[model samples]
Target: MYSKVAITGMGIISSIGKTVEENFTSLTEGKKGISTIENLETIHKDVIKVGEIKLTNTELAQLLGLSSDNNYSRTALLGAYAAKQAVQSAGINAINEYRTGLISSTSVGGMDMTERYFYDYFKNEAVQKYITAHDAGDSSHKIAEYLGLEGFVSTVSTACSSAANAIMMGARMIQAGKLDRVVVGGTDALAKFTINGFKTLMILSDTYNTPFDNHRKGLNLGEAAAFLVLESDAVVKEQNKKVLAYVSGFGNANDAYHQTASSENGDGAFLAMEKALQLAKLDISDIDYINAHGTATPNNDLSEGRALIRIFGEKVPEFSSTKAFTGHTLAAAAAIEAVYSVLALQNNVVFPNLNFQTPMEEFDLMPQTTLKHKEIRHVLSNSFGFGGNCSTVIFSKN
Candidate 1:
């Protein structure tokens, strides 16, 4: 069996807030970050709402102390900003003190710049520096460089499930003795590409997303970056690190049922949750809360709802999706949700699932709609993404 991986620290920058504390406040207070686009310029600005970070690229560059000549894309800047917080939160002055690695995920690396300079790159050499930042892995490299990490750096692009898988990989590496510590999560900046992509799917909600509601229309795209420092038990003991939570369970499975649609019975979601519970060696009853992957999309809610019913039978615990507060952050959704889950465990409160109304006709699942205070011990977070990727992570109070 692999050794248990402990989450020492977490950092996040999302549309809701720039720091973990701010995001937590927004989550608990039912304050949403979704609004008209402010930072990104696009033709579809009026039609689609987004969870933009509201910081200009130049402002972010200045925050990172980069010169005007720097070629950092918005995604790289956001990733670096959040990763730096995670490293600092972990109380590590030297990142290379042990065998450390970084596993970051992103569906849109530098598309914000690519879309802006698609035609300008040929005419202006100054903007050509951003051409190399267009790939998915490039943002991870930039974050690694910013943190001075030099081992096992990689990126995963499983659409919305990217960060959950990144966290999963980080935990597995520690379990397998491949690395003593790893910074794991995902990042993505708002872009016209994703706004249009979800528009094409007819899953871009005009109003706030209503996950698990029968009248749910679609999701609001959001931008965010979050990272969790996963360290082995030995490393935690050696460094006297404070454990935020224990990543007790994790599982990833592909639906293989469709390219972008979940199976009618939520086969992949069911398997992933089941596998996670098995790995955690806990019964379903032990779970206190579920941060569901309720994107408010019609297909996703139906599929995920069925899966929850099948897994928990009749005694499912209180569950809610924080997407209403932060919108759907695509690849970074799982990572940010993981951070929210840990916060729930730490504070002993379950954040409300805003915008929820009528229960779905297909299932009787109703999400917690108010800030419920209770002794939270273990929480389960689910994140299902496009391309049939489904992931589940269980975080326990340490």
Candidate 2:
């Protein structure tokens, strides 16, 4: 068995709210953050709604104490903001006190700046600085620099499942004694690239996203950053840190069945969930809630619904998707959902899966459409992404 990986602290900036407490309040009160695009200028502004963070690049840059001469992308700025919050919440005076690392993930590292300066980079020397920040790993490097973390920095980009894998990797590293503590999560800012990408897929919901509903249309794209501080049990005891929850189980599997589509039978989802249960040494009956990866996309809902049925059979726990409140946050989805899962465990309350109305015709599974009060002991959260990547993480109340 691997050493326990405890989530000591977490921070998030999403459409729903700017801080972790703000987000938790919005989530429990059934507040929706989906609205017309505000920060970015895109052609699809009127046609689509997104979970925008409501902070401009200039505002975020100011918060990060970056000068106008800096070239930090919106993704990097938002990531630094959340990461700093997590570090502060953990009450760590010296980040390098123990062997530490940072594993961040991003699908659109700096596309927001790239799209803005695509043509200006050649004509404007000031804009050329952002050119280097246009890769998958640049934002991660910036986050590590912000936190002064010097060892074992890496980035994962498995689309929406990226952050979950980052958390999983951090846990494994601690288990292998590679690092005593690690900051892991994902970040993505709104961009025309993703807006049009999902638009092309015909899965952009014009209104609110309703997951697993018969009348569901599609998903809303959102931008946010979330991070978790994972430390080994030994380090936790040595530092006397406050343990928020334990990452007792995690699993990752690939369908390899399609590039972006899930199997009809949800084979990849089933494998991922089963693997997580196995790692946690818990049974299906142990899960008190499931934070589903229900993006409300027709294909995803059907496929994820099938997977839930296969895993839980007739006694699925009360579950919901916070996506309705925060929109699909791409690389940040799993990380933010991890925060929500931990919140559920701490409060023993299951937040409603907003916009869920009717059950699907194919499966009998029904999500918790309204805030349900229950003693949530173990929560299973699923996050499936393109490239057939499916991941599941189980958080236990300690």
Candidate 3:
């Protein structure tokens, strides 16, 4: 059996809240964060709702103590803000004191700035500095610099599953004895390009996203960042850290079915969940709650529902998707949901799936629509992304 990786700290900044406690409060209070776009200047501003952070880019930079002249993209700003909070929460005075690393994921690294300066780069030298911050690894490096981490800094950009895969990779690195501790998560910011891209696909919901509902429309694009500090057992014991939860299991699989749609049978989803259960050394019944990857899109809810039935038969544990609360955070969806899973494990409560009224026409999959108190020992969180990327991470009480 692989040694369990302990999650000592977690931080998140989303539409619902800025801190972990705030997010928990929002969840418990049934506060929905989805609303019409306010930060990004998009043509579809009136037609599409998004879970955008209320803070402006300048405000975020101020929170990070970045100079006005710095080329910090919104993605980097959000990532650094949340990662620093995670470090502080873990009581990490010196990040380099341990063999530390940072694994961040983002689909839109600096696109928020690039789209704004795509035409001004040649004429304006002031904005040219952001050109180098346009790649996927730039945000990860910025987050590492913010945290004073030097070794094994990397990034993943497998679309929406990016953060879950980052968490999975962090756990594997710890199990393989490569790093003593790693901060894993993802970040994304609202941008006109992404909004238009989703609009072209016709999945941007105009109102609150109702996950798993028969009348469900599409997803509400959101901007947020979240990070978790994963430490090995040795490091946990040596540092006398307060363990919050354990990364007991993780699995990833690809369906190769479509570029933007999951397979009809959710093959990748099933395999990923099965593999996670096997690694956890726990039976399917041990998963007391599921934070499903319920994006509320017609295809996703159908496919994910089928996958749950395949794995759990008729005994699927209580499950719900918190996307309605925070909107679909794209690459950060899994990371934010991972934080929610840890919160559920720590608090022993099943977060409500928010905004579901009708069952699907094909399946009897009814999500937990109200926050229910239960003995949540284990939580299974799923995040399925484009290009058939499917991932599952299981968290247990430590």
Candidate 4:
């Protein structure tokens, strides 16, 4: 058996809140963060809602104490903010003292700035620095530099499941005696590119998203960042770390690399959950709460619902999707949901799946529509992305 990687600390900034405590409060209070587009100038501003952070790029950079000329994109700024908070939460003054590393993920990367300066690059040298920040890896590097970390730094860009994979990779590395501790998560900032891209796919909800509901429309694009400090058992014992949770298991699978739009038995999601249960050495019933990847889209809810029914048979545990609270945060979806999973275990509560009135006709899977307190020892979080990327990670009480 692989050693369990302990989650020493976590940090998050999303539409619901800027801190972990705030997010938890929002979840417990059933406060939905879906709102109108405030920062982004898009044509769908009046037609669609999004889980957007109200802070501006300037405000974020100032919060990080970045210089005026720093080339950090909005994605990097959001990532550094959350990562620094995670390091601080973990009580790590010397980030590199324990062979530390950072694994950050992003789908948009620096596209927020790229789209803004795509035309002005040739005429304006002032915005030219952002050209180098236009890729996914640059955001990870920026996050590491901000954290003063000098170890294995890598980036994962598996679209929506990016952060879950990052968390999985970090835990595996630590269990394999490759690193002592690692910070893993993802960040994404709203961009016209993504907003318009989803709009083109006709999945942007005009009002609140209703996950698992039959009348659900689609997902609302959102931007946020979250990070978790994962430490090996030895490091936790050596430092007497206050373990918040443990990365009990993780699994990833693809449905023949996409073409899963028809469910096909939720091939990828089913296998991913099955593998995660096998890795955790737990039965399918051990999962007390499920932070579902319910994006409120017709395809996703039906597909994921079918997958859950297939796995649990008649004993599906209490599950809810927090996406209605934070919209679909793409790359950061799994990271934020991972944080929510740990919060559920810590507080012994199941967060509500907001804006649901009716269950799907095809399945009897009705999600928990209100906050329910329970003995949540283990939580299974799912994140399925485009190109058939599907990932599941189990977080357990430490």
- lDDT-better candidate, 1 vs 2: 2
| Residue 70, model 2, lDDT | 78
- Evaluate model 1: give its lDDT: 0.91
Cα shift from native, residue 192, model 4 (Å) = 0.5
In model 2, the runs with Cα more than 4 Å from the true position are none
What is candidate 2's lDDT per residue for 1-398, written digit by digit as tens? 65458999999999999899999999989999999998889989998889998888889988888887777889999999999998888987899999999999999899998998889887988788888789989999999998888888999999999999999999999999889989999999999999988899899999999998988999999999999999988988988889999999999999998988888889899999999999998988999999999999999999998889899899988888899999999999999999999999998899998987788898788899888888988999999999899999999876
Error of 1 at 311 (Å): 0.3
For candidate 4, lDDT tens digit of each residue in 1-398?
68678999899999999999999999999998899999989888899999999999989999999988899999999999989888899999989898899999999999988888889999999998898799999999999999999899999998899999999999999988899999999999999999898988888889899999999999988899999999988888899899999999999998964543525578899999999999999998789999999999999988899999999999999999999999999999999999999999999999999889998999888899989988989999999999889999999985
TM-scores for the candidates:
0.98, 0.99, 0.99, 0.98
Better of 1 and 4 by lDDT: 4
Clashing pairs in 3: none
Residue pairs in clash, model 4: none
lDDT of 2: 0.92
> What C-alpha lDDT, on a 0 to 100 scale, does residue 61 get in candidate 4?
90
Query: Which candidate has the top score in lDDT?
Result: 3
Which ranges of candidate 1 are over 4 A from the true structure? none
Candidate 1 displacement at residue 368 in angstroms: 0.1
